[model samples]
Target: MTECDINNQTISRPGNSWLAAAVWNNSYTYKVSAHCPLHYCLPYSTHLNFSIPNSQCQFKRAGILCGHCQQGLSTIFGSSNCQKCLNIYLFLIVPIAISGIILVLLLFILNLTVTDGTINAFILYVNIISINTPVFFPQLGKFTPAYTFISLVNLDLCIQTCVYNRDDYAKMWLQLAFPFNLIFIATSLIITSRYSTTIQRLTARRALPVLATLFLLSYTKILLIVSSVLFFYSKIFHLPGDHTELVWSVDANVPLFGVKFITLLIACFIIFLILVPFNIILLFTRWLSRFTLINKFKPLIDAYQGPYKDKMYYWVGLQLVLRVVLFAVSSLDRNNNVIIGIVLFILVIGLHGTTLRPFKNEIKNYQEKIFIMNILILFALALYNHGTTNMTAVNVMIGLAMGHFILIVIYHIFTYALSGVTRNKLQLHINTLVGWIIRLLNKNPVHQSRLDSHVMNKIPTAVNYHEYREPLVVQD
Candidate 1:
């Protein structure tokens, strides 16, 4: 077909009138001729169309623009501006691509003929890396690189909102992160559930999946709650001087309350409703299991028993959810109040963990305690240095945090090295050294007199010794 004929044919195609009208409306100076084809602009447009009702526009329906609108927008605003709108998808794609690769790798590793311990250890290493990445590189917080490696994990959303004052781009990335997180969580749960019998048979051989599940679940719950608080609660119940950005929109009339926000609020409420009763039942059943009188209901109790790790998972998960909620609420406070609230919260958690020893492994419990202590100290330093003109306190806090991490690494190395026979030998040496130090420090006359008396008591009487000595001489 001739170019003129093709142009004529394209202009005659359906939806051209809407595009023409949008283009004319957007560009008052540009007049649309009947002979001009819409394809001369661009193939598509994802921008909103004000010429029609929001319900009629594709951008309003989906967060993306329709082809007709894209053409109209390009015709009016040029192709460069239109391309910028398309670049947003790159943010969505990058994380998804990375997560897809990680997920595939995990599946492959899980299928390998490896010991559960090895798999669990590998997973634990990955989880540690995922959790600490954002801590080390705060810039990646916006992109949420943790979600890809660990599956559905995120840093404190409340901190991201209050401290960072994340812009729309970050919000968009978060919105994208949520679904990918859900998919990852769901996939992990399904895979782990399939291995539930194996996991039970192996006992503590498979802990990472449980911990990962709990961590994801807890973080997901926090994400939902914090998102709802940011998008819905903060919007409806505005606090004085509260200028925090909403997850969806900053303006009141933007109609940006999309399906995702509403779905988030609903999911948050549903989960809360379900979790409350479910946890009550678990707690009540657990309590019942402790009583000897309930031995008749052993089968029923056993059904609910789950794994010990599962219980620990729930406990740790609950702690995480509670901590996040408190932090989210406290983030509403001004000045250094949030930091103070966080320090207090961490202190309470540390005390609880120390007293309860939630983890099955004593080592894990001790490690967590040390971590909490380190975090508390760092936060305390930060709080003291807040609003200070000098960078010394900030530097000190950073240095201390880094040093604490190094200490933890060294501790793990020592712990690994001091296992089995080496550990026993080390313990004997330590005891000897401690005893020698005690003796060296007890040089005071009163302590010496008491020690000499104790040694004398340990000896036989002189009369008994003389009698025993005479017996020996008689034998000679």
Candidate 2:
């Protein structure tokens, strides 16, 4: 058939008959059309008017639906009903769950495998290096190479192992270690300064030497963090083995590993840094024997008033001094750090509780505020201990800390909410009384109109209502 006739005319043929038209050209141009109404091919008359071409003209057989529909059908029939469980399945719950699992696994690996050799070496070197004095300050001595290794390469390794292998716990610790250490340093510095200055002025002696030594100890805390990170990476991921492992114990149940040993060593170095100066002070100064609680308070109260600020600053200063001393004593005997830590635990709680007392009337509001402040403090402390602590142990510590913080947070929220309700009620009563007064003063239209005009024209007075006047009383 001709192409022109095929395009214009509609014709019916047998069920499987095909139609082809060749155009008038040197080369034959064939066009094939099919009609298969049983399988709804090209088209059959339904709501729309179109013809279904015979299947015989088709190159390949056509199905009712595409491959996608087939697969969908198979899934529907073979798999469980996705729609029925879509609320849980379609949401981000699965992705979050999977990510959480992966994060936990990484933390597990980091906690179980990372070592602490580099940290111990650094601690030893810092103590040894600082022992020689100011000439070795910026210069690289024998200890300088290890210090260089930590700054240049160990940092990256710590970050990698902590972040990728240990992830959640590592990141958490890294974030917290810096701020906490800073707090400790600042607190220690303040106490040391106060102690030295007080001793010099009161006793007619120079305590600068001892104070300077105390200053040296603050830096060791930072070194400890750095060393821990380095040691973890060097031993955990880069060790000579196919499988890497982290092996620090966070709980009483678990045995301590090299990392823990390093951590303890770092703690010891910090003690030495603190004690060496105090010992020097003790040797020269008979005032050390006479050092009493009253002397501490005299310096403290002389500094501030208002119980809250006084106690806070005093407690912080005291804690710093005590921590340094405790750390020193503990170095001589580790059981001592634990005993001191227990004492500190009690003192911290007492001081923290005292802070809450000032806001007892507004407990809820106060608690919320306190919680936020504590969170910041906790964050700082955590940063200082990051790679230095075991991942699993660190995580548990953080979780418990957060729970402790959250309890206080919830308490404060309710307190504020109650205060708000009380304030609203008081305001409502004031509004009602004002409305009643306005209604009671029902003057004539002219008087009322004049009063309104006068009110708008004049400047407002200190006294709101001019209608009521009272005799003034004067006192000699």
Candidate 3:
């Protein structure tokens, strides 16, 4: 063996083996991005002359291989740690509790009906006024009508126009849609861009896992974007104008097959739209958690290098787009079903916002904003629903509102709970990858060879981490 001192001073005496010693202090910390071929090519034990006769005995006496030394081999020292399973009980339990509370409230409201009390009459008057206020939609006359759908459209138009002349809700609804939709799209785009950049910048040894996570995120984003577009197109199939007169089914029991088809299409769109976003968000979150864990052991991984790494601006942009789109698309019609669909769409967008990369940082604030927005929107809806053409029409609007509320709540709970479980599964996968990386780095081929020599002096044996983990070490 040849040896050199800390200053690269080589000592070669007559007939004696050469010796060299170079102390790599903290100042010479490993540069993960740099090409340090010598350190990588030579096994640690061999380079340090730990194979000298009696060196193992000395190691034992010095307590270098004891419990304290074993700590160096801990999972914490690896590139990442295992992810703990997320507690799903909280997600499943809390919503059920809230539903029970709401059920009680619903029962109370249902049982308090009155025939002709002063307050009842007042409510009846208000409900009547609400029903008949829609001469506002251009198609509807200058006054509300007796038909339930026509009256509801009238009430919506009144709210939008403060009268029955024009579609008032259209502009606000359009504004709401664009910003909300943009939230998920923008965040997803940023995540993809940042991930690609990270892969390009990373060195070969560290690039595999980063590349894998990037691929996962990119694929997920693509799926979501495609799904979102398909869902919107599906909604367009269910035209805004009433088509009862165009019913083609021969059977009286199923007069409007178009309606049923549209309903099924909408349901499919809603399910796909809801599931895709949740799936993508959960996957990204798992990747993020893995990044966090790996960051602890290898701080050079550059978790904060991406432009979208902070992500607050991404969310704000999404909000802006949602607002614009919502305002535009919401004006096509004001049928109870249509309005409910629009509301559910808005809520879905809000839920996507909650799962965006930086959402957790401001979840409470976002929740408050969503709550306030929903309350105001609902209040307006209530006032609009009140302007029916008749008392019976007003009751129908109430039923529609109740049904919409129930559907939205149920959809939200299912998506949110599923996201949690999906995130947990992703974390577990990343953890496994991290553990593999650490083992690949520290295992010494020379030591393994020496042990093999002792076990099988005459047999040829091959065991290598690089072979299993990557395309062998590349020499630049």
List per-candidate RMSD values in Å.
16.8, 30.8, 42.1
Give all candidates' CA lDDT scores: 0.39, 0.33, 0.32
Question: Which of the numbered candidates is closest to the native, going by highest lDDT?
Answer: 1
| Per-residue lDDT of candidate 3, residues 356-474 (tens digit) | 43333344344334433433343345446543333444445544443543454465455444554566887888899999986775487877677677779776555975555755657
How much is 20 displaced in model 3, in angstroms?
98
Off by over 4 Å in 2: 1-162, 165-313, 325-333, 340-407, 414-476
**Which lDDT tens digits does candidate 2 get at residues 152-196?**
221111111111222122332543343344334434545565668
lDDT of 2: 0.33
Flag regions of model 3 displaced more than 4 Å: 1-280, 283-367, 370-376, 379-476
Candidates ranked by TM-score: 1, 2, 3
lDDT of 1 by residue, 275-362 (tens): 4544444455555556686566443333323223444433433444444444444334325443554556576566657566555555
Top-TM-score structure, candidate number: 1
